[model samples]
Target: MTAEVDAYLSALPDDQRAALSDLRARLQILLPDHHEVMSYAMPGFRQPGPKGKMVVGYAAFARHLGLYPHSGTVIPLIDCAPFKTSKSGVLFTPDRPLPDALLSQIIATRQAELAAGYGKR
Candidate 1:
């Protein structure tokens, strides 16, 4: 992680910082095979397999942290509730948090989406 992203995440209130940190840490645990690095001016974790370079690949955004699966199927996972995604994202507000359950779902879905070659990756 870059000092910038670390600083950014660290600067938030303790709860918010912890929320993002927990999500980032969980991503590491869930995607051990993925390449974790700072990309696109954010902390990114890529699939790190034969097709790794296909995408940026996963990034943490300004308010919410997320991944870029490339296939775009991730849209549906957030379409329902707790998340509202546009054609490109899962909208995140500073008020609402990126939940652990949802994080797990996103990780699992990402694994599937990556396997399916969805979005940029």
Candidate 2:
């Protein structure tokens, strides 16, 4: 996490703070090699995909903690669609628990999107 991201997360209230933390951990496990950075003033991770690199970002809004896959990889898939996340990324409301299964599917689809972009691999 970048200093900016760190400070930003540190400032969140306890509830949002915990939810964002969980998101950060899961994203890290999903893309361990992703380079962490701050993008558009938000914490972001860039991971290599099949086609190119994929970027995931995070933010704790007043009502939700956003996990941005950035890429459109998971959009068309059904399992991940429940979380939808609009045209942006997944959203977890404060006090609402994070869904591990949904996060896993999102990560997997994002990776596959990158991989498929490269080739049949």
Candidate 3:
């Protein structure tokens, strides 16, 4: 994990930290080749290489934690029912973290978008 990300997580409350840390661990496994980064003030993983696109990101909020796909289109493509969702992220509490399958789907969708040259700046 990057120092920026470490510090970000370190500053959160225990429950939020634990929840995000667990999610981070799962992401590390899913995107083994991706590099950890802090983008848009949130911690997330980006594809490897200097120009690698951001694949996924997440953060802790006052009332919940959010998973950001880095692309506004990604969250809408997935089934985020039973949880709160915005155009670019999904929110859940530490008590009810996102399921493994759903997280995987979120990552997959974002990766696909990156591969297709969406979100290029």
Candidate 4:
């Protein structure tokens, strides 16, 4: 994890911090080649491509955690019935973190989109 991301998570409440940390670990496993960074004022990952840039991000909020798939188009296409979602991101509470399957699907979809050159940096 980057120092900026560590500092950001350190400031969050315990539950939120733990939730985000777990999510970050899962993401790292799924996208091991991606580099962690601070983007859009949140913890983000950039997969090195012909043009390296942020492919996903996550943030802790007072009421929810955010999973950003970079493009507005991607999150809307995800079947997020179990959780709350908007064009920008998926929202889940600390106590009810996103399931591993759902998180994997979201990351896979975003990875596919990026590979297809659908979402530019």
> Please, what is the whole-model Cα lDDT of each candidate in the order they appear?
0.59, 0.70, 0.92, 0.88
**Model 3: per-residue lDDT, tens digit, 4-97?**
9999999999999999999999999999999999999999998999899888889988899999888889888888999999998999999999
- Give the Cα error of residue 87 in candidate 4, in Å: 0.5
**Per-residue lDDT of model 4, residues 1-121, tens digit only:** 7999999999999999999999899989998988998988999899866568578899987788999988888888789888889998999988898899899888888888877887454
User: Which TM-score value belongs to model 3?
Assistant: 0.96
| Winner by TM-score | 3
User: Highest lDDT: which candidate?
Assistant: 3
TM-score of every candidate relative to the true structure: 0.63, 0.78, 0.96, 0.94
Ranking, lDDT, top scorer first: 3, 4, 2, 1
Q: Residues 1-121, candidate 2, lDDT per residue (tens digit)?
A: 6777778779999888887877787778877877777777788787654444645788877766787777654645635444436655777676665577777776777777766663334
Q: How many angstroms is residue 8 displaced in model 4 relative to the true structure, after the best TM-score fit? A: 0.5
Alpha-carbon deviation at 56 in model 3, angstroms: 1.1
Once fitted onto the true fold, the runs of candidate 4 whose alpha carbons sit more than 4 angstroms away are none
Q: What are the root-mean-square deviations of the candidates from the true structure over C-alphas?
A: 4.0, 3.7, 1.0, 1.5
Clashes of each: 6, 6, 0, 0
User: Which 10 consecutive positions of candidate 1 have the poorest summed lDDT?
Assistant: 53-62
lDDT measured at residue 61 in model 3 versus the true structure, 0 to 100: 82
TM-score for candidate 1: 0.63
